[model samples]
Target: MHTAITSQPLPSAAEAALARESSRVLSACLQTRSDAQQIELHDEQGATHPVRVPVSALRLLLDVLTEIGAGNAVSIIPIHAELTTQEAADALNVSRPHLVRLLEQGDIPFHKVGTHRRVRYQDLMAYKQRIDAQRHEALDALAEEAQRLGLGYD
Candidate 1:
């Protein structure tokens, strides 16, 4: 079964408050680099339950909360997950055929599963980072060349 992942709605007032609190807690806990911490949750029944959370998980939660606090929707995807070419293309914001060409050229790594290519989420992210770095370097070089020619913005 396939499940669609979508960004969540903006946080409500109460949620915003919780987000603030979570951010504060995360900031404090991250400084100590604690392995795990237990958080108390109080339900409508007035019963408190303690749940253990890893520091990494808490950090991710804080990031999500911060985005929501800023009125931005957020969604999470695991880095190790496998993705189809179409899904990878959608994530990369490119046409499927373009992505296929990239795959064919070995620009992005993929493995075939019964004739269907599957890309790892981490691999795609790594490729994106590489492309972004290359783009940044090229832009920097262009700016330097323009500056050398006295064509830079005032």
Candidate 2:
């Protein structure tokens, strides 16, 4: 499997401002009923070029712009991509050893590549969603119990 890791520095204040403006404009443009839109780009030398972009791609670009405008870093991973233990751990915000334990315990679906283990991005996301839902359920139950006990929880 071919995996590409890309890391970019956070946007500067000026860049963020530009991203905010650009996203706002793109959002307005996307309200039209069309599969594709024509957008114009201006070069540094005062040259203009018109390009047609698919609506789906434009929507994705808008999302990226919005995140950058909010000063958040973004990374794109294909659903079918295979990730290393460290990469999967980083995606789940957990330690590598913990991810390894989960893999060994069959908590998440993974496969062995020779002697190394690789996790599919889709399987990892599914595991994360399941765990998050369970945590939410537990929290809700705890809150309900607290309310029943009249512990002054609003």
Q: Which window of ten consecutive residues has the lowest lDDT sum in model 1?
A: 1-10
Off by over 4 Å in 1: 1-21
TM-score top scorer:
2
lDDT of 1 at 97: 96
Candidate 1, 19-115: lDDT as tens digits: 7787887777677556988889999999999999887888888898788776677878787788888888888999999999999999999999889
In candidate 2, the residue pairs with backbone N, CA or C atoms under 3 Å apart (3 or more residues apart, or in different chains) clash, namely none
- Clash counts for all predictions: 0, 0
Q: What is the lDDT of residue 72 in candidate 2?
A: 79
lDDT of 1: 0.83
Candidate 2 structure quality by residue, lDDT tens digits, 1-154: 8475467789999989999999999899899788999999999998999999999999999999999999877888888999999889988999999999999999999998999899999999999999999999999999999999999998
**Weakest 10 consecutive residues, lDDT, candidate 2?**
1-10
